[model samples]
Target: MIRFEDVSVTYDAAPGPTVQRVDLIVPEGELVLLVGPSGVGKSTLLGTVSGLVPHFTGGTLRGRVTVAGRDTRTHKPRELADVVGTVGQDPLSHFVTDTVEDELAYGMESLGLAPDVMRRRVEETLDLLGLADLRDRPIATLSGGQQQRVAIGSVLTPHPQVLVLDEPTSALDPAAAEEVLAVLQRLVHDLGTTVLMAEHRLERVVQYADQVLLLAAPGEAPVLGDPAALMARSPVFPPVVALGRIAGWSPLPLTVRDARRRAGALRERLAGAEPRRATPTEPTPAPGTGRRWAGLRRERTAEALPGVVAASVARLAVRRGRVEALRRVDLTVTPGETVALMGRNGAGKSTLLSTLVGLLEPASGTVRVGGAVPHRTSPRELIRHVGLVPQEPRDLLYADTVAAECAAADHDADAPPGTCRALVDELLPGIADDTHPRDLSEGQRLTLALAIVLTTRPPLLLLDEPTRGLDYAAKTRLVTILRGLAADGHAILLATHDVELAAEIAHRVVILADGEVVADGPTEQIVVSSPSFAPQVTKILAPQEWLTVSEVRRALDAGGGEPW
Candidate 1:
C-alpha cells in the first residue's frame, strides 16, 4: 500500500541528501520495520509516507512517493490525514492538546469524523493502550511512557490505513511496549492495516515485523528483505541476533526463544566462565572519591549501607491528581553508585526520578540529595548537588545554537568555558558546533542535554531514558562517560527501558511496580532473574550467568572454543 519510486530528499541545512534513491514497496496489511543507525534518514523516510518529507519539513523530494494508491507528492499532510498516521520520535512535539482524552480525539476532529465515531474510537484506543485511567490527565503532567501512549492513541484513533512510528516503544517499559506491539499485530492481522515503523529498540519489535527495511547509510540505496536475512548483515541488530552470530547459529535467531533452543552446549561452556565486566577509567583523585578500583570488585553486600549517601527517598508518597504515582517508595543511592530504575509503564519510575530532581513534591515522607532537601534548595544552589537529564531532552535545551547552549551551560555552572563543549564532543562526535540545537537529531539533542547537566559535575546525576534515540556507537560513548563519572565519585540514577543498556552499565537495579518498590539488588541479581527484564544473552544462556554479547565474547576469548 506504500511505494517509493526513486525517492531522494535533501534538507536545507545539511550537505547532500539524507535519503537517496530509496525505491521500495510495502504491501498492504503488512508491518514493515525501518532499521538503521541514528540520523541515517529513518525518520526522513517515514516522513515521505504522509507527505511530511518535502511539505512540512521544507525539503526537496526528487522522486515520487505514494501511499494507498495516492501520491504523497500531490497530497499534503493535512490532505492525507485519513490515510496515514505518523508519530515522530518526540511525542511532546506532536501533541496539540493539553489532556489525554482531548489529544486522542483531536486528530479525528481534524479529520472531521462524526462525533459518535470519534468518541467510540477514543474509548477503544484508551482501553487498547491502558490509558483509560489517564484519559483526563493533562498531557504535560503525564510521564514519558504515558505521553508516548497518548501520542500513539491520538494517531490510532484516526483509523488510518497506514501507521508510521519512530521509536514507538523507546519510552515505554517492557509490558507496555508489548501491549503496543500486540495492538499493532492485531491491526495488521485482523484489520488489514499497513504499519511502517522505525525503531531503535530492535529487540522489542524485530520479531513482529513482516519485513525489514534496512537503510544502509546516507546516499546508499535501501535494502528490503526478510527480518532474519537482513539482520545477519546489518550493523544495527538486536542482541539476540548478535548472540546467534557469536554462536554460529544458522538462520540467525530473531527472538530469544529461537536462540535459547540452540544454546545448550554454549550454556554449559559458559557456566563456569566469567564474562569481562565493564571497567571504569583511571581514577582522578578528588575528595570523597571511592572508585579507586571501580568495576574491578563487585559491590560488597557486607555493609548494609554504602558510604556517603548521595540521595535518599524515604516513605515517599507522591500523587498526581487522583493518581498515586508513588506509594511509600523508599530508595537510596550512595556516592559512586550507578542504579538503573526500571518498571512497566506508569509504574512510578519517572515519578521517582522527578522526585529526585525536586520537580515533584512527595505527598508525605522525606527526601534528600547531598544532605540537602531538593525541593527546598534554590536553583542556584541545586546544581552543585544534583543534575537531571529529563526523559524529554528538549525540555532541558533552550538556546539557539549548539555552541550557545554549551557556553550557557558552562556559564550557568561556573565551570571552565570549554567544559560543556568538551563533554559534547566526547558524547556526540562530529556534530557541527554552530548547528541549532532544535535541528539536531533526537540522539544528538539528548547528548547535548547530558553535556549541559554534566557541566556542573554534580555529585548525583539523574537521567531518564538516556539511550532513547542513540545508535549503538553513541550509546557506547554514553556508557563510557557514565562509567567514568561514577568512578569519579558521582552517583547516577537512570530510568530506562533498554534492558541491554541496563545490563551493560548499571551496577544495581531497582524495579518498581504499581507505585511501590518491587525488587532491588545487584544488577545481575535483578535482571538475569526476570524473564521480561533479562538481556538477550541472559535469555539464551538461561540457567547460566551471561548477560551481554560482550560477556559472551569475553568468555570465548578466555580459552573456551566454540561449543558447536
Candidate 2:
C-alpha cells in the first residue's frame, strides 16, 4: 500500500509546485492509473513513491509518502528496493548489464537473494513478459520494444510488493502490451501486488486499472475516482471513451467490448454512410509557377505523383550481425504520401527505417531517396533529400541547452537563424530556450528532436516511434504539423506501434512481420481487417470499417443528425 499525505513538490527557481496538496491512499493489491497531460507531474508523483523525487532529483517535498509501512521520506530508493520496483520512461537508462538474462537477474543479485531463487524468478519473468527468446540477446542489439521488455523483467524479477511504472507499454506492440498488462493484472489479483503506473497511451491501459487518479493541471489538487466517472470529465482520454461521449452512452465505455456492446444502434445509423473524404492542404506552388506541382494534387496519392518518388526500395535486404533484419522488401513513397510502417517487436520496421536513413547499409538490393542511394549519399547532400528522427530522441540531441540545439539545426540545414527554434515552439509551446535537453521530459525531448529534423524540410522524412512520449494534445499538434508537411509535397514514413496515430494520420499502412511485408493497403482496409492492429473506433464499429473518432464525427456533422 502507498499513501501520500499533503504531498507537494517544487524545484529550485520553479514557477510553482509541480504537484500541490496531493493527499491520497493506494490500497494493496489494486492497480492505480495516474492520468494527466504531459508535464503535469505524473512522473514527479511516481518518483515520490520510490523516493527518487526529493532524494535523487534534487527537489523539495513538502509532505510525506509511505510505502508498505516504510516512510519514503526516511528510506532512500536503495533501502526500499526490497519492496519497490520502479521503471522510468527510458528503458535504456535503466540497464546495468549487457545481456537480457543478466539484466533480469541484476536486481535480485543486488537484493542478495539466493541464487536459486533469483534464477527461478528470472525465468518466470522472462516467460511472463514474452522475453524468453531474447534472454540471450545483448541489450544493445535488441529493438526498442525488446529493450523495454528486458527493463520491465529486470524489475519484476525482484518480486517487489509495489511496482511503479512510467509509460510501461509505450514502446511495445499491441500484443506485447497486452501480455505485459495481463502479467500486471495477475500480479494484482493473484499475488496481491500494488501497481502505480503513469502512461500517456490511455487506450491501452485504462481498461486494466482498478482506480483512476487525475492530475488535471499543474499544482491542481488531484482527483481519485472510478475509471468511468474520471474519464467522462478527464481532459485526456482514449478514443473509445471519446466515441462513447459522442454517442451519448451512459457510463462512458472504458474498453472496446464495452463500446461495441452499445454500438448496435450507432452502427445502424452509420451503415450506409461512408467516412468523409480527407482534404489535405493544397501543395505550395513552385517558385515561378503559380499552379501546384504536376506531381502532386489536392487529393494526395502516389498515383498522382508520377515520376516523383521521394523514396524507393527494391528487394531490399539488410543483415545485422548474423540476423537477417530485413529480407527482400520492396516499398515506394511519393511526394505527397504519409505511410505508416507497423509490426510487432523485431518485425524489421525499425530496420527498414534505418536502411532508408542510411544508418544501416543494406546487405543487398537498393535504397534510393530522391534519386540517390541513401547509403552512398554524403551527409551534407543527404540533408537536401531526407531526414530522420530516431526512436531515441537523445541520439539526435547533444547540445547543452535547447537554444544551442535549435541554432545548430538551423546552421546544419542552411536555414535562416531561429527557424528550428520556431518549429520547437510550434510543436510544444513554452519550452524555455535556456533549459538543458537532458532536463526535459521524454515527450518534450522527442518534440525538440522532431523540430530539429523538420528544420531541413527534406523531401522524405522518416520518424521511428514519433509518438512515444507525446500526450493527446501534443500528438494532435504533431498530426497537424505532419499533415501540413504532406500537403507541402513532403513524403513521410513513420515506423510506429501507435495504431491510433496511424488511424488518424496515415493514408496507407504497411505491416512487416519477421522481416517480411505481411500487409499493405489503404489505412481503413489494412487496420479494419486485422484485429490486432485496428484502432478503438474501428473495433467498436466493426463491419463499418471506420478508423477514427474524427471520421465518425465528420460523418455525423455532415449529415446533421441520424440519417448519417
Candidate 3:
C-alpha cells in the first residue's frame, strides 16, 4: 500500500534531508512497525505516506513516494484522506472538534459523506475503540490515552485501508497503551487494515508486528527485515532483546513469554551442568539510611523525615461537568521520597497530579502540601514548595535564552545575581548558552526545563512523563539529576508509564485504577512482586531480589559468578 523509492526529504531550515535515500515497501494488509531513536526521521517517513511531508511541512522531496498506487507528490493530504488515515504523536494538535462524537464524524463530513454514513461510521468507531460511553464528552477533558484513541477513531471513521501512526502510545500509560494497541491489532487481524506505526516503546508492541523497519541515525540507511532478528542486533533495543543477545539464544525472543520459556531452558541446562553454592547475603544498612555513605550520607539521611508530610490528597473528587475524572482519591507523599504515580490512560493520573499541584480544583475533598492547602496557597508561594514539570516541556519555556529561562524561576532574592546562570551552566553543558529555548532539540529543551524548575529548589517536585521523547543519553542524564535531587530532601512524584525508569529511580510505587490507589508500597515489592505491574526486565529475568540493573549487578558481583 505504501512505497518509497530512494525517497529523501529535506526541511527548508534543516542542514540535510531528514530522511535520506529511504527505500521501503509496505505490502497491503501488513502491520509494519518502524523503530528508531528520536529525531531519526520516523515521523518524516510516515508523513510521506499521506502527503504531509512536502505539502504541509513545506519541504523539498526527491525520488518517488506512493500510497495505494497514487503518487504522493500529486496527492495532497485531503485528497489521500479516503485511502490513508494518519495520526500524530500529539492528539490534541490534530483535533478538529471539541467533543468525541463530533471529532469522529468530522472527517466523514469533510469528505461529504451522507449523514447516515457518517452516523454509522461514528457509532462503529466509538464501539470499536470502547468510546461509546464517552460519545458526548469534551475532547479536552479526556485523558492522554483516551485522546489518542479519539484521534485514531476520528481518522478510522472514514474506513481508510491504511493507518499510519507516529508514536501513538507515547503519551499513554502501559494499560492504556495496551488498549490502543489491542484495537490496532484487531483492526489488522479482523478488519484487514494495514498499519504502519513508529514507536520507541518496542517491548510492548514488537510481538504483534508483522514486519520491522529499523531506521539508523541521520545519513545512514534504514534496515528492514524480521522483527526478532532486527531487535537482537539493533543498537537500540528493549531489555528483553538485550538479554536474549547476551544469552546467545537462536531466533531470539521478542516477548516476555518467549524470554520466560528460553530462560527456563537455560536455567535447567545450567542446573544440570553443575551444582552451585548458596550465595551470601550482603549486610543491610541501618534501618533508615539506605546505601549512601560519606559526603552524601547527611543529605540522604535528611531526606527521610519522621513526621513531616510533603503532600496529601484527602477524599479528592474531580468532575468535568457530569463526568467524574477522579472519584474520592486519597494519597500522600513524604519529603525525600520518590513516588511513582501509575495508571492506564483515563484512570485519572493526570487529573490527580493537577489537583495535587492546585492547577485543577477538586470538586470535593482537600489537597494539602506541607500541611497547607494547595488551592489556598498563592501561585508564587506554591513555587517555593512545589514545581510541576508538565508532560509537554514546550509549555514551560518562554525565555529567549536557556540561561534566562532558568533565571526566571530562581526564587532566592538574596542570592547572587548570576545564580541561575551558574546553575544552568552546571546542569546543562554543550547546549549553546545563547540558543533560543524553542530552537533547541527536544531533549535539550527537556533538560532546560528541569534546570529551570530546579532553580527554585522546591521541596516537592512533580514531573509528568519526563522521559518522553528523550534518547538513552538524555534519559541517563535525567535519572542522574533526579537521583541527586531525591537524595537531597526533595519529595519527587513522577507520573509516567516508563516502568523501567520507575524501577530504577522510584522509592515507592503507587498504581491508580479507576481513579483510586489500588496498590502502594516499596518499589521492589510493587514492581517485582506484582504480576500486572512488573517491569519488562523483571518479567524476563525474575531475579531473586533486585529491581534495577545496578541492583542485579551488585547481586551478581556478590554471588561470585552466579547468574541473577
Candidate 4:
C-alpha cells in the first residue's frame, strides 16, 4: 500500500539528506518491521507515508512517495487520515481530549463521520485494544501503556487501511507490550490492515514480522528482505540469535520456542567437546567491613527519619466516577531504598505514582508525604523532598538554555554552589550553556531533565520510564548514574518496563497487579525465577553466580586461564 521511489529528504538545518535515495515498497496487507540505530531517519521514513515529512515537518522532498494510490506530497495528514493512521512513541503529545472515550472518538469526529458510525467504531476499537474498562477514565490517569493503546485506538477508529506506529510498545511492560502486539497481530490477520512499525525491541516483535526493513546508517541504502534471513545476517539483533548463528545452527531459531526445539540437536553435536571453563567471581572484600558499612548506612537513614513517613497511603480508594481506579490501596517508602513498581497497563501503576506526588487526588483514604498529606501539601513545599521525572520529558522542560534549565530546579533551594552546574556538565558535556533546551536531541533532553531533578538532591526520587528513547550506550550510562544514587542511600522509586535494567540496578522488585503488590523480593530472585521476565545474558549463560557481562568474562578467564 506504501511505495517510496528514489526518496531523498533533506532538512534545512541538516547539511545532507536525513534519508537519502531510499527505494522501498510495502505490499498491501503486509506487516513490515523497520529496524535501525537511533537518529538514523527511521521515523523520517514513516513520516513519508503519513504525509508528515514534507508536509508538517517542512522539509525538501526530492522523490515521489505514494500511499494507497495517493501521492504523499499532495496530501496532508488530515487529508490522508482516512487512509493512513500514525501513532508516535510519545502518546501524551498527541492527545486532544481529557477522557479515553472522547480521545478515541476524536479522529472519527474529525473525519465528519455520522454520530452512529463514530459510536460503533469507538466501541469496536475499545474492545479491540482492551480499553473498555478504562473508557470512562481520564486520559491523564492512565499508565504509559494504556495511554499508548488509547493513542492507537484513537487513530484506528477511522478504520484506516494502513497503520504506521513508531516504537509503539517501547514504554509498555512485558505483559502490556505483549497485549499491544497481540492486538496489532489481530488487526493484520483478522482485519487485513497493513502495518509498518519501527521499534528497537526486536526480540519482542521480530518473530511475527512478515518482512524486515533494515536501514543502514546515514549515507547508505536500506536493506530489505525476509525477517529470518535478515536477523541471521544482521549484526544488530537479539543476543540469542547471535549465539545461534555463532553455534552454526541451520535455519536459525528466531524465537525462544524455536531455540528450545533445536536445542537438543545442537547440544548433541558439541557433546564430545570439552566443557568451557566458567568465569571467575569478583574478589570479596573483607566481608565483615562491607557488612559493617551497610549496617551503618541503614542506621543513619533510619535515624534521620523524624518518625514521619516520607510517603504513606491508607485505604486510598480512587475511582473514575463509578469504576474504581485504585481499590483501597496502601503503600509507603522509607528514607533510603529503591523500589520498582511494575504491573500490566491500566492496573493503576501510574495512578499510584501520581497520587503519591499529589498530581491526582484520591477519592478516599489518606496519602501522607513527610508528615503532610498529598492534597494538603502545597506544590512549592512538595518540591522540597519529592522530585519526579515524568514519563514525558517535554512536559518538564520550558526553559531556553540547558544550563539555565538545570539551575531552575534549585532556584529557591539552598543547594551547594555549582552542584547543579556540575551535575549538568557531568551528564551532557559540550552542550553549550546558552543553547536552547528544545534544540537538543531527544537523548540529550532526557539527560538534561534528569540532571535538573538531581540538582535538588531530593530525599526521594521518582522516575517513570526514564529509559524510553535512550540508545544502548545511553542506557548503560543511565544505569551507572542510578546505581550510584542508590548506593548513596537515596530512596528511589522507578516505574519501568526495562527488565534488564531492573535486574542490573534495583535491589528490590515489587510486582503490582490489580493495584496491589503481588510479589515483592530481591531483584535477583524475582527476575531469575520469574518466567515472564527476560533473563539477563549473564544469568542465562552462567546461572549460578554471574549477573553482568564483565562478571561472566572474568569467570571464564579464571576457569580457562588468560589466553593472551
Top lDDT prediction, candidate number: 2
Kindly list the per-residue Cα lDDT of model 2 for residues 1-564, writing each as its tens digit. 899999999988778898989999999999999999988999999999999988999879988999999998889999999999999999999999999999999999998999999989988998899888888888998999999989889999998999999999999999999999999999999999999999999999999999999998887899988999999999899999999888898899999998899899889888878986343234322132323222222232333234578899999999998789999899988887889999999999989988888889998999988887888988888777788999899999999999999999988877778888878877889889888998889999999999999887777889999999999999987887787777767889999999999988888899999999988888878898998999999989988889999889888887786532
Between 2 and 4, whose TM-score is larger? 2
**Residue-level lDDT tens digits of model 1 in 1-564:** 998999999988678998998888899999999988877899889999988888888879989898988898889999899999989999989999889999999998888899999889999999999999888888987888889999999999989999999899989988899999999999999999999999888889999999999996777889999999999888788889888888898899998888888888888777777766543223222232234223222232113123478899999999988788899888888877888999887788888888888888889999998877988888787777889998878888998899999899988987768788878887778778889887788888999999999887888899999999998778877887787777766788998999999998887889999999999988888998898898888877878877888778877878656766
- Deviation of model 3 at 68, angstroms: 1.6
Model 4 agreement with the true structure over 1-564: per-residue lDDT tens digits: 888899988976666887887898898887899876656778888988899888987879889999999999998988899999999777888899999999999988888999999999889888877888889989976777888889988988988899999888877878767877888888899888999998877767888789999875766678889988888766467545654665566686777677655555434433333332211112122214344234223233333346535577788877755557687676776555666777677667767777778888888889877676766788777766677888777778898887677567657454555566666565545566777776555556777788777766566778887777665545666765665555454567888787766655666777777876677776666766776664434334433433343333444445453222
Q: How far is 31's C-alpha from truth in model 1 (Å)?
A: 1.0
Off by over 4 Å in 3: 265-307, 399-448, 542-550, 560-564
What's the lDDT for all of these models? 0.85, 0.88, 0.75, 0.72
lDDT of 3 at 382: 72
> How far off is residue 439 in model 4, in Å?
5.4
Off by over 4 Å in 4: 112-120, 190-192, 216-219, 228-236, 239-252, 262-324, 327-336, 358-384, 401-403, 407-444, 528-531, 534-558, 561-564
Write down the RMSD of all candidates, one decimal each.
4.5, 4.0, 5.2, 6.1
Pairs that collide, model 4:
278-555, 279-555, 279-556, 280-554, 280-555
- Using TM-score as the measure, the top candidate is 2
- Per-residue error (Å), model 4, residue 365: 6.3
Residue 524, candidate 3: C-alpha displacement in angstroms: 2.9
Give each model a TM-score: 0.92, 0.95, 0.85, 0.80
